[model samples]
Target: MTKIKICGLMTIEDIDAVNQAKPDFAGFIFAGGRHHIDLDQAIKLREHLDPRIISVGVFVDAPIEEILKAVNSGAISIVQLHGNESEEVVDYLHDKNIKVIQVFNPTDEKFNTGADYTMLDSDSGEILDWKNLLIIPDILAGSINSANVDKAIKIVKPKIIDVSRGVETNGKKDINKIRQIVNEVHNS
Candidate 1:
């Protein structure tokens, strides 16, 4: 089965809604953005989540110390790097026994570097050049929704699929859209 990850979760309500939706992974953005959450709020949200669901921390060029602090607080499992972090950073996180997911635009050649996983996002909601990603493994396409997720899956055949803005309607996640995207991915 293709793994589904719902990113950019912000509030307790969002957490509850996503928990009800039952995605394989729920992401918390600790970096500054519309979806950013504080450490305390992430801990509070993590407390309410079921053990079967994985909680991920999203960071963008944050200090390794700060990332470690979030990991220690409530982000016990995965960390997704959405900025220009070095392979050394990934190695350090790996040494600490934390799963690292590196994010990149399709044109970035560094995606092939060592990391537990690599995600490709359509740099401005535009579809990526899938032909350039033939040999990459354990890749997940971001900015995916029910509309283009099937195309991404068919072209990339990624082991995982991640959606954030695509699943949202008016700044809130749509459960039916999440279900639709997941279903289409599986069926494809």
Candidate 2:
């Protein structure tokens, strides 16, 4: 079955919702976007997260020190790189035994290629041409929701289905949306 990740979680309420929904992974955007949460807040949120579900820290052009701090704090178990992180950086993180997910645009040639996982996105929230791409078991992200999730799974067949805005209502995580999306992907 395809795994689900509800990304960009901000509040304790979001954590509680994810606990109920029980998605495979929950994301915390620490790169200071609209869903950005501070280290202290992330620590608090981690206390309430379901232990079975993995916690991922979404980063873009951030320092390794900060990423290490989050990982060491037990708030984040994985790091998803959404910036122009070099293979060296990936190696550095991997050398420390930290799991990494490298984000790609599908057209970007400069990639870390050594990531445990790769997230493919158009940044426009539409599913990319999976046929044009090679390799399976990659994570598909951007603009994924309940409506198109089934199609994405059957067509794209991504190892993991990732969503953030698609599971939100008025810029916050919605439990119903999260559950619906997960069910749709799983059923597909």
Q: Pick the candidate with the highest TM-score.
A: 2
Per-residue lDDT over 1-188 for candidate 1, one digit per residue giving the tens place of the 0 to 100 score: 77788888877777777777777888898889788888888888899887788999989999999999988886548998989998899999999999999888766755636788877776587666776764454656655678877777777788888888888889887777777776776677
TM-score of each: 0.90, 0.94
**lDDT (tens digit, per residue) of candidate 2 on 41-151:** 888888899999899999998999999999999999999999988888899999999999999886776656799998888877676776676545489986778888887
lDDT scores for all predictions?
Answer: 0.80, 0.87
**Could you tell me the C-alpha RMSD of candidate 1 in Å?**
1.9
True-structure RMSD, every candidate? 1.9, 1.5
- Candidate 2 Cα misplacement greater than 4 A, ranges: 134-137
Q: What is the lDDT of candidate 2?
A: 0.87
